[model samples]
Target: MSAQPAETASGFATEGFDPATATIVAVTYNRSHLLAGLLESIVRMDPKPGHVVVIDNASSDDTTQVVESFRDRLGAELVYRRLQENTGGSGGFSEGMRVAYELGSTWMWLMDDDVEVLPDGLARMGAWAPRFKSIQGRRYDYDGSEFYWQYRVSVPLGIPIPFAPAGFDDAGYRPMNSGCFEGMFIHRDVVRRIGLPDPRFFIYWDDTIYGWLASRVTRSAIVNEFVLKRTREIRQWDMGTRHLNASSNMYRYHIMRNRGIMAHYYRAHGAYRPVYFAIGTAATFVKEIIRLVFVERTVRGTSNLWRGLRDGARIRRDPSFRVMPPLEEAPS
Candidate 1:
């Protein structure tokens, strides 16, 4: 774990700053080529992290080789672990963060392998470290245009509210109660306070629930100064409900199940009313039906929707869930 000191007026890091305390925890699966580009961007950061932990979700490709290729170029020590089984994105991050905290990291920067960080990304984020417990960096598509994640979770209705993206450019930091893990910067204490992200979610809504938990305990914001470029284009919302219809069976299952689980969480905690829960659940079911009839033009996917909602209703929280153990060395 290491970092070159930032160039400052005094030619040193801030008085008490120790770069070794920050670790970047990145998760990847099957996209070795994209992973290589992300590592390259990390190597170019003006103020790099002390260490980087890459969690591979049992990718059946040369992902390990991609990490090894960058060992000589990165200032931060690279710790790559390929999981024994595919545990999905939620599991990868859960394990990576646990390893980072155990390594004595005071801060953890979370991201996906599909992003290339700006050269000064960490440097700019480090400036706001004192003011917030967690900070989410801005993101742009491969084309260099900003990605608009305009909707935030409305906890009561268990739905999303469209927020205007207009005024954020002038604000140094925008306060946010929810979280997006892509380019998220968080202090170690917050992790200890809230616990690692839930892996049962498998993929969707895990970060959203985790982010909400963090905000409940301390401050979090979106920083507009730093940037991360997404390597892939998102076609998820291109054809209205067709997007949902086109998703893989696994994705469709989780998309529906996770919402029920999240709704269960909010309701159990008394954050919303029973009436709103009824409305939310009904709305979700109707939307799925619309996709099957109007977009997919087939009834085959309906079984997954029904099964997901059924399982989610009975899915109890696991308080003793442990993150997957880390590897002693990068795999060959």
Candidate 2:
């Protein structure tokens, strides 16, 4: 789809983009304290989001109460949905996007409860709406340093380009094929074309595939503008330029298991590389082993890698493991 320029009454030109047409979709699970901070940040936005959709993944805590407290303070409409069970970040985002789309939102700003949006973040992202449909804003690490996020995807290998440039170009933005859910600002039309994030991923790599799909249909890029700050801090291995955070056993399992699902996406997009993917998968297993032995100082979770590999192989062969199509195609 092509973007058309139009000027608003205030003389600001856009591709029919308006902040009032955007909806914030946040997925929270047992993090009321963090969720409250995120909501507070949204309330302070210069042009506050037109709507807020919070998907509570069956948290036993007071997540519902915290959301209600902001109803009066926030000027926008708030919709809260609590699931009966935890559906992981992927499922929550999928549900939240579905809800926001059903509400007729033109734009969806997706994020997690552990991060707080900057007051001018949405405005900076909106400036590029006249040019691109799938956009990602910058983020701050827990230590207040700039996060390393700019990179394109190696579809054949199903991994991000490790040696990609670190910063944006002279245009203040860089084209990207991978997507990060932390601060993804996308138009509804892109969602209509790419469909919701795959829930089967459960966690890891779902955003990358979604972003790749969006890039196939529109101009997808990540801008050099700080949009949010990560509130949660975890022990990380300093890799000179970047830091590799510690991962839980569950994360390790899903991260490996999801590679099988990723292969399915690669083949669907006509970029399948069996030998390269297998080599990459083996390298990942070795890396995880090193992290567990050196960084984590434990080998208790080593079985997760093998189990994940087994499950992934099964999923890759299953005919039912398919990409979800757009519910409604964009108007031609």
Candidate 3:
């Protein structure tokens, strides 16, 4: 990717005003390899964004230096922030938005660092910006790899479900409640109103909740005309604990607990949502019990199931399970 800046007029007649205003923020945690690949794609953006912020999630493995090396080359166009510890993508993006907003950004694009960006991703998104208040997301070459948890429904359940308006069906994705962080481009005004991604959800389904929140603030659409390629298995939550792994019982815990959170938020807020979460949780618990008893593979994973059961039984109060680092507000 080339870092050639588009020539903006310079002189007293041209007040350092930049008309091409958009910012893309990529969030990463220790995946310097993925971060470098995504950065190369940013350099190739045709109508490149005014800036890109790489929010490093406390990566211990040289990710800070990797991004710094890139910024040293890109200068003001690429700014990097290294947090003290990994806060998952939710915390990374929350802090990332804080950083992007300070840089005079008019719009923000949320993406994960471990991916290949579509050369025209931002340009096409910018083209559609005038049409809607927000764009949900789209990923390239998707064969259901990462995680496609479930379908989304806009408006509360008791209320009639609304259909996507004209002009979005061609994309082949339903215009639903929310979207993931993959390639969602957010207009700056919405962020000012809705605030950042909910950090209460440390790891699971936070995007779904965020998408629901985004819809309340603005009319949204899922755009797949362009896409990003991510090389991971997508949503590797409940990944069995192994050496050198950041395993958290929170994966199961959040699934169990967040179901209650969603239920309270939407059902009380009156979406008449399904108990599908409850059903899934119950089924998983039964399977875990069977595995532990029959297959006889008793490991920390069993404890994870126990955590899920405990949290699910009392899901109301178990909101955020993360320990925040002592860090300053995002730099202005």
TM-score of each: 0.83, 0.93, 0.70
- Who is ahead in lDDT, 1 or 3? 1
Worst 10 residues of 1 by lDDT: 321-330
Compared with the true structure, what per-residue lDDT tens digits does model 3 show for residues 170-263? 5544555676777777777777666677665666656776667677768777755555776554322243221111334556566555555555
* RMSD in Å for all candidates: 6.3, 3.1, 8.7
Between candidates 1 and 2, which one is better according to TM-score? 2
TM-score, cand. 2: 0.93
Which segments of model 3 are wrong by more than 4 Å? 1-19, 72-76, 141-151, 154-173, 233-250, 267-302, 312-332
Per-residue lDDT of 104 in model 2:
94
lDDT of each candidate versus the true structure: 0.74, 0.86, 0.61
Better model by lDDT: candidate 1 vs candidate 2: 2
lDDT string for model 1 (1-332, tens) is 33444564323243234556789888999999989999999888767789999999999899988899998899999898889998888989899988998888988989999999888777667767778888887777666766655325677766644543434655577777677778778888788777788777898778877777777768888777646889976534434212332455676678678875676566545685667766776677777676666655667787887887776665524444333222233235
Task: Write candidate 2's Cα lDDT for 152-205 as tens digits.
Answer: 877766777777887666899888898988888888889988789988898998
- Candidate 1 is scored at a TM of 0.83
